[model samples]
Target: MQVLLASPRGFCAGVNMAIDSLELALKAFGAPIYVYHEIVHNRHVVEHFQERGVVFLEELEEAPTGSTLLFSAHGVSPEVRQKAKERDLRAIDATCPLVTKVHLEAIKYAKEGRTIVLIGHEGHDEVIGTMGEAPEAILLVESPEDVDALEIAHPEHMAYLTQTTLSVDDTSRIIARLRERFPLIAGPTKSDICYATQNRQEAVAKLSADADLTLVLGSQNSSNSQRLAELSKEHGVAAYLIDGPQDLKPEWFEGVETVLVTAGASAPETVVEAVLDYLKEHYDAKIEPRLVREENVSFPLPRELRQLASS
Candidate 1:
């Protein structure tokens, strides 16, 4: 068996920074560093941190007053930040810069008196945070159909923003429809979708053709990871989204000549290696590394974290 291990497959810049922040906090401040969310969507990463005394909290009240709390990469609403402040918790932001861009866009459009249509799945952490920026001014839409059904209070004063981790093709279609109805929409393209999401999907869309089956390394709740698997299946290849090697089934490899393996941005590279090793040991698979695009983006640790570190 031949394994096509994709390049740029795991741990994008934002994930790297978020994980680094957690590790640094744990090292400098000792165990029991409080985090507002999973830090990223990966179960393995969260579990690893949890074992080290990193407490993940869903509610601000759960954290003790004056505890150090880190926000997840998905970002959090300003409301959450205010509550943390009220609780006197020292909050460390780990929000990806790309997601922050969408939140800022929503704020800009809302302040201009424009109704913003956010192109993203409902309940997603990133979407929830951005919508919080201008909840009254923003409406959520998942498809072009949603665009057609929208009755904007002021059609001429409309704009759009998107979750950074969405499929480029899906967002493009929705943006097109929004343009047809609201020609003056503030954001006319899917530029809000992050580069990592677009690159990974493009790689899978291009390489899945040669593989009999494609395995995506990511958690169920990871939006970008889900898109990679769904995008592969759309290209007519069988794809499975698994958290790690343990999720791989023998049936998926039956009669499969070539297997394409890719990891989501939030997924750890160690999981990818373990999955590859499982295939190599069990099936005597040969690894073939394929890099679709090169990425060199990096975000520094949050300013607050840096200040804390210096002090």
Candidate 2:
């Protein structure tokens, strides 16, 4: 068996910054540090932090008064921030800057009296956060069909935004359908999908074309990982999004000569290596790195952490 590894896979700048912020917080403040959600969507990453005494909560009230809290990389709405403030909790925001950009765009468009059409899966953390920015003004749509079904109160005054982690190809198709339906719809000055998501999807699309099978290392809740798997199948290749080697089944390798391995932006490289090690032990897999592009993007730590360090 031959294994093709995708370059620029695993741990994007946003994820790195989020995780590093948590680590530093833990070191400085000690255990029982509360995070609003999984620091990232990867199960392994979350579990590792949980073992280290990081508490993951879905509700703000669950946190003790005056306790330190870290927001997930997915970002949160202004209401969440206000609620945290009401509770007097010390908070560190770990939202990806790109996601924050979309939120800001939402605020700008809504302030302009434009009904916002958000292109993303409904209820996704990032989508929810972006929508919450202008809930009264934002209408959520997941597909071209959804766009067709939309009946806006003000068609003449509308704009569109998207989840930061979405399939680049699918989002483009949706955008086209949206423009066709609402000929005057305005979009962001720049794309809402972040650079890491676009680059990873492109790399996987190319790899899937040549490889017989593609394995994406990420959790089911991970939006970008799901897109990578879907894109592979779209290219007429079989793909699986697995958390780690534990999820791998021997049946997947049957009659497969070339396998492409890639990881989502939030996934750790260690998980990818574990999968590779499993294949090596079971199938004597020969590994070859398939570099489609080079990624050097880096994001700074949360402002609170930076200030703490400087102080």
Candidate 3:
């Protein structure tokens, strides 16, 4: 068996920043730190922090009053922030800057009286957060079909933004549908899909063309990981999105000669290694890396963490 690894496979700048923020907060503020959600969608990352005494809470009410609370990289809505404030908890935002950019764009467009169409999955933390910016003005569209059913009051004054992690091809199709329906609709200066998501998906797409099968390393709840798996499937290749080696099924490798392995932006490199090791041990696999892109992006820690580290 041959294993092809995708370059730029795991841990994007946003995930790195979010994890680092928690580490720094622990170093500066000590144990019992509360994070609003899994800092990223990967369970391994969250479990690692749990071992270090970081408390992950889904509800603001669960967080103790006045405890230091950190938001996840997925970003949070104004209502969440207001809830935090009402709880009188000290908070630090760990939202990806790219996600923040979309939120800001929503605000700007809404203030300009433009109807905003958010292209993303419903109920996603990032979408919820972005929608909170201008709830009344923003419309959520998940697919080209949704765009067809959309009813906007002012078609001439409209704009669209997308979640950071989305299938590039699917997003493009939706955007096309939006344009066809609203000729004067505006959009972000740059595509809202972040560099990491774009690079990872591109890598998988390229690798899947050559391999017999593709394995996307990520949790089920991870949007980016799910997209990678779907991308491969769309190309008529068999793909699996597994959290780690534990989820690997021996039957998946039946008559499979080559496997392309990749992880989502939030997945860790260690999980990739574990999967590779599992394949090698079981099937005597030979590993090769498929280089699709060189990612050099890094986001700095939050200002509060920076000051603490410097001090």
- TM per candidate comes to 0.97, 0.98, 0.98
Error of 2 at 78 (Å): 0.8
Across 249-292, the per-residue lDDT of candidate 2 in tens digits comes to: 98999999999999999999999999999999999999999999
Residue 218 in candidate 1, Cα distance off native in Å: 0.4
TM-score of 1: 0.97
| Cα lDDT over the full model 2 | 0.93
Instruction: For each of the candidates, give the backbone clash count.
Output: 0, 0, 0
What local distance difference test score does each model get? Answer: 0.91, 0.93, 0.93
Against the hidden true structure, what lDDT does model 3 obtain?
A: 0.93
RMSD, one per candidate, in order: 1.4, 0.9, 0.9
Candidate 3 clashing pairs? Answer: none
Query: Candidate 2 at residue 240, lDDT?
Result: 98
Q: Cα deviation in Å at residue 122, candidate 2? A: 1.1
